[model samples]
Target: MEEGKPGAVAKVIRRNPKSGQREFGDLVWGLLPYKTERPTTAVRPIHARAETVQELPMFADAFRSRRAIVPATEYYVRTETDGRAQRYVVTRADGKPMAWAGLWESFVWPGDRVERSYCVITVEANATIAPYHDRMPLILKPEDWPVWLGEAPGDPAILLRMVDPDVIRCEPVAQRRGNR
Candidate 1:
């Protein structure tokens, strides 16, 4: 549950500004726009909805051009049953790592103080996740990586609209007293 928590450092894949190539970099798990004054001064958002990523003020610029990918072996989701919370581990059926669609931002201040963070893009839950939650990260297949990362030519909006429900596999996790 603490894997992608805010303030945590995570490996991210985004286009290299200088070389226009894909590069691996570390970024904070929560998004902080350029307007933000400090890392902890704002309640940074960790997820951006697909339906609004392109239109909302918070995500428009990054969604349109600063897209990134978060490669993950698995992610957790939750549901409520009998007034208690149930958790599930979501992964690809083929066991390959998933490329979760994301957006990144960088903030630079005087004296070269720089900070970067990102947020996962969420789309309406597919059949596999509908029973557990209403939203899930926008999972980008390998083929679409280019377009999503701006490494190749293609439409990224089409990807945000929908994802095949059968792509991921989820398994129930046993609950612990203090885990949520």
Candidate 2:
């Protein structure tokens, strides 16, 4: 399975509302709200800010109900370094896969075809990533996965807390294959 990039599909885990069982599936990286007038990615967002995710019209509902987790081994980012562009790879220092917090939605196309899409959440960069970018993917710890996934009784306010910087590590890599 390939890691998700903007406009690409990625593996996801979401709690099934009816059965309360976790379901594993693939969802496109960009979110297309369920009742959008027409299908298009021009305005679809691949990332939602942690501060506004629950208040933003495009993502509020999904954040309240359709929470999901996108697992990945690495997160790549392109940023300027010494007046030149550089690629940085971010991963867990503990050697665990990242559980990225996200929201998923099902949009219906003209012919009534339903398409699933998701957007990763972002937060102010922690110490580990602050040098690379001002913002970074919101990674959830195992203990918080239940709340983020709506699988247990917990307040959504928990999301306001950012991931601990100690678990993350960043390395600048030569711009090469698989930059995305």
Candidate 3:
């Protein structure tokens, strides 16, 4: 997936309120057409900080009602080395897919058109990723999926914790991925 760009679609899994079953679908990368008090406001937030998602005006509503999980085999991060950008690929140490916490929203544009989009939730970096960046996606364990998807009735905030550093592996790679 293209990082930080809008319109890129990704597969996501979310809980269906009516059926109480997990449903899979494609969602646009960035939240858009968000309503604001000012008619000229333009905002497309790509990442929502997990620490304040429950209180942030842009994400609070979705955080409470539309939490989701983004399953992926790996993700990329960039760092500066010798004044040049260096890229790194991060994956689970056990060769398993990871579940990233996310929030989704449906917005209607001016012409009665509707679109659904989502943003990845990020938390402070753990020891493994701190050398590359100060923030990392909030990776949830399989056992915590039910709680995060609201299948169980516990506080979702508790699931925002970072993954254990030992469970993650990072490797430097060629910087040919894309422009940052």
Candidate 4:
């Protein structure tokens, strides 16, 4: 994780579209060549703050090429309470599936082998999420999905404006206190 990345990790796993894998969704956690020395867990940074995307080498080229969409039922973020850290789950106020703007990369290691992985792109929080955390995932709206998913060449400025305060809803959860 970098200085601006958020908590929780995500990976774009491969799903065999023709068989049982298709029933489970198109993702299966896999190892990456970019692991930070420790090989115990593959839980790498899932959310990278959008503001810092330019600084992340993995995202620099990936963002322009293999940009992806993470369809999440709900995503978790963290905050602080009484000097203790807490987590928060951000779901659609309408209770619909929402997609997080993400970038996927292929990490190949030595030994004539290869490992691949993916990460979600986050952005500065809107009014709905700022109180809970300084940043939130760059969620694209239904109408914007085409542009976000590369159907259109998106304007960075316009895309940045998508994180407006009006479109989101936030709630505080009691279970969040246990995350720390």
Candidate 5:
């Protein structure tokens, strides 16, 4: 799913400890299921800061127990220059799809209705993406996917740090296809 928009559904991967297997599920893009009582003006967050996911009230529980990964071939960022907006596509230098770190949660509304949603985790941008935006999604290395999915024992927070800049490359692109 593209950044800055909500309601997009994407495939998410997480570990099923009960079966010792990895499972795939669909999740709505913007997280923290909206409540009927919430003001119409309230905004739902689509991204969680990597540095604070473990402590923020909305993300803490999910950070500990529902970590996930969102696979992507590339991602886009927008930058404004002299009143004009330009888009840039960022991808791995190795030409491989990326596993973006994320968190998921299942919200139970009244009447036992359940909604599963997720938010991409972002950290301070590395050099490759710094010019386009101040933050970028945490892209995990293949070797660390098991750890991020909780298939192995390790600290997710440590894995959330910015990846080395050399692994990523960005290029300016024409206007994106959809309205976004």
Candidate 6:
């Protein structure tokens, strides 16, 4: 279990299914396994509401130590306006890829099988992404990558307050992003 928060189990691998000659059913959700105080089942909620990390214990620890940087060429977000959920692609105007703040952990099972999982951290959307949704992934500035993923532990409160707003630029995109 990463930082102690139960992770979402279904994970979408970065590989192209066609290249692997795999069926859609072959996909599996990645959930970080953890040892808890009781008989709690592992669950990968898949979608972590950026606003609720504090209430969820898993992120608390990772937010401090296991934090990571999730690199992305672009990211899809949904916005509801005029009664429809519109899809938006947020990218860098300069065309460079970016990374979102995240936390990761590795879990080993009974047969020496190891599972690595990650969760992107989020917070209230900045001015740029605010119009689209109330929450957005915490996009890390390149300069802060080392700090966010550094070996030293950080104070979650101080780190959470270090988001950069100007790095995100949102654009209207096709509704296909709304699909799972």
TM-score of each: 0.90, 0.90, 0.87, 0.64, 0.85, 0.66
Runs in model 2 lying further than 4 Å from the true structure: 1-3, 174-180
Output the worst ten-in-a-row residue range by lDDT, candidate 2: 171-180
Cα deviation at 161, candidate 1, in Å, is 3.2
RMSD per prediction, one decimal? 2.9, 2.8, 3.2, 6.6, 3.6, 8.8
lDDT of 5 by residue, 1-180 (tens): 564368788888877647868899878787764332552343557899988988987788888888889888888888899999888888898999888999877767768877778889999999989988999999999899888888889987789899899999887775435434
Model 5: worst 10 consecutive residues (lDDT sum): 33-42
1-180 in candidate 3: lDDT tens per residue? 674356688888988768989998788887653564442365777789988999988899889889999888888888888999888999999999988999887677679876678889999999999999999999999988888999988889988888999999998765335544
Looking at model 4, which ten-residue stretch has the lowest summed lDDT?
22-31
Q: Best lDDT goes to which candidate?
A: 1
Q: Is candidate 2 or candidate 3 better by TM-score?
A: 2
The residue-by-residue lDDT of candidate 2 on 73-147, one tens digit each, is 987777876898888888899989999888999887889887888988889999888887899888888888888
Provide the lDDT at 26 for model 2: 75
Cα lDDT tens digits, model 4, 42-140, are 455565667766566645665565556667777667777899866677788777877677665555445645444556676777888878777777877
lDDT of each structure?
A: 0.86, 0.84, 0.84, 0.57, 0.82, 0.56
**What would the per-residue lDDT of candidate 6 be over residues 59-169, giving only the tens digit for each residue?**
665554555555567777786778987788888766787666666555666687666566767678778887877777676666655455553344444556424566667
lDDT of 2 at 30: 88
Each prediction's number of clashing residue pairs:
0, 0, 0, 2, 0, 14
Error of 1 at 162 (Å): 3.7
Decoy 2 TM-score against native: 0.90
Q: State the number of backbone clashes in model 6.
A: 14
Model 1, 37-144: lDDT tens digits are: 665567789999999899998899998889999999888888888998778888898888989999999888677888788999999999998898889889998889
